[model samples]
Target: MQNAVLAKVPYGEEGCAEQHDSDLTAVIIDDCRPDLSLQRFALQANGRFKEIVEFNSPVRALEAFATKSLAADLILVDFRMPWMTGPEFILAYERLAASYKPTPHIVLLSAMPGAELKAYEINSRLLLAVCPKPVSLDTIETIVGKIQPDQ
Candidate 1:
């Protein structure tokens, strides 16, 4: 029953209506790793959304969000960025999207072990998942679980 209820939540690619940009539109925000490479990895992750945008800088990411259209189905933000931390980025993103009628899905990806604590300190519910470093194909599969509908 709980799973059924969770299926209706819009925390991921599942359970949500068809977005305007439904071709796996995603944003990869990572400073340490190569965005293009990570984007390709995400594409092969077998998720509902696709990787479309990649940003190595969190500040540029915020600018992209402000200047460009909010068409991304998911955002994979890395932790421990130079300009802004992952949590900070999320906070800023949330504030930026507050004006929007509905917020989009965001996934925080980090290699640091302490990233979890930061995520919990902020809005635990804002992030759909926290993917650790050394991401693998199998790990991606494991993380890309069944999408549940928004309750």
Candidate 2:
């Protein structure tokens, strides 16, 4: 599964230049495979993110961060997962080596009502917003607009 998924995206040592720019490396972590695919498609269609990396496992996503293979300017994380919750992932993400610099803008996604507000209150500094499930293009655009372009 890992090999197949990795092949779909340019996450190798020699990353794909066409897939990324200096502005934003967006990572989406969700346990639902279909949801992951949907998010990736939406982001690609919107054409804002320099790169879009999808992980069905929050644990693997963290591993990517631990190895410095993943450097994100924007992160969209599902609030509930088997391995770890969204808040827990955020905590672990904060401890990653890539996090030492300016922290990435994180948006938590959940089906629970008012989850976004709660997530923002928990760590407004890192979390940009909380979005409901079935994330929309408008929501993605709104969040992307908040991020300053690379100088």
Candidate 3:
């Protein structure tokens, strides 16, 4: 599974770009088979973002949930994952909200368009938007800009 997933993204050692220092931070959680190149491209094109934290595993992301609440201003979550789906993460996030010092904005993304409707039916408040993968940087930038105060 790991091999197949890595093949899909083909991770390379790109030198870390200088980190942007701003109050707003974004967290991106996706299944292993994401188009990371597209994600990076979108991020680069936006140019308004500060910091971004990415996780391939929902479990690992959950482990660092506390840290997210401390620093993140917004979170972008994929709808489908191996062990935990995006909506499930929101359920867990709701429970964890009691302990979160500051609540971060949450948005949902999916390759499937229907998932957005499902997410909306589940709870409109939990999800800010549902976007398809390979989404353009302009679209992502617009969405992020709306959510982040610093953007």
TM of each candidate vs. truth: 0.66, 0.79, 0.71
lDDT for predicted candidate 3 compared with the true structure: 0.61
lDDT of 2 by residue, 77-101 (tens): 9988888888889888876744345
Angstrom error at residue 134, model 3: 1.9
How high is the lDDT of residue 74 in model 2? 83
Off by over 4 Å in 1: 1-22, 45-47, 99-102, 114-120, 146-151
Cα lDDT for residue 30, candidate 3 = 75
Q: Write model 3 residue lDDT over 1-151, tens digit each, in one string.
A: 3312122211222433343444555667776434555664566455544556677766666767745533456777777788788888888877765545445777777777674456455474546676777667666777766764632
Where does model 3 exceed 4 Å of error? 1-21, 67-70, 99-102, 115-120, 124-126, 148-151
RMSD of each: 10.7, 4.8, 5.3
> Which of the numbered candidates is closest to the native, going by highest lDDT?
2
* Per-residue alpha-carbon lDDT of candidate 1 for residues 43-117, written as tens digits (9 for 90 to 100): 444544543466777787787677655445566777777888888999888777665433456677666676445
Model 3 backbone overlap count: 0
Instruction: Order the candidate numbers by lDDT, best to worst.
Output: 2, 3, 1
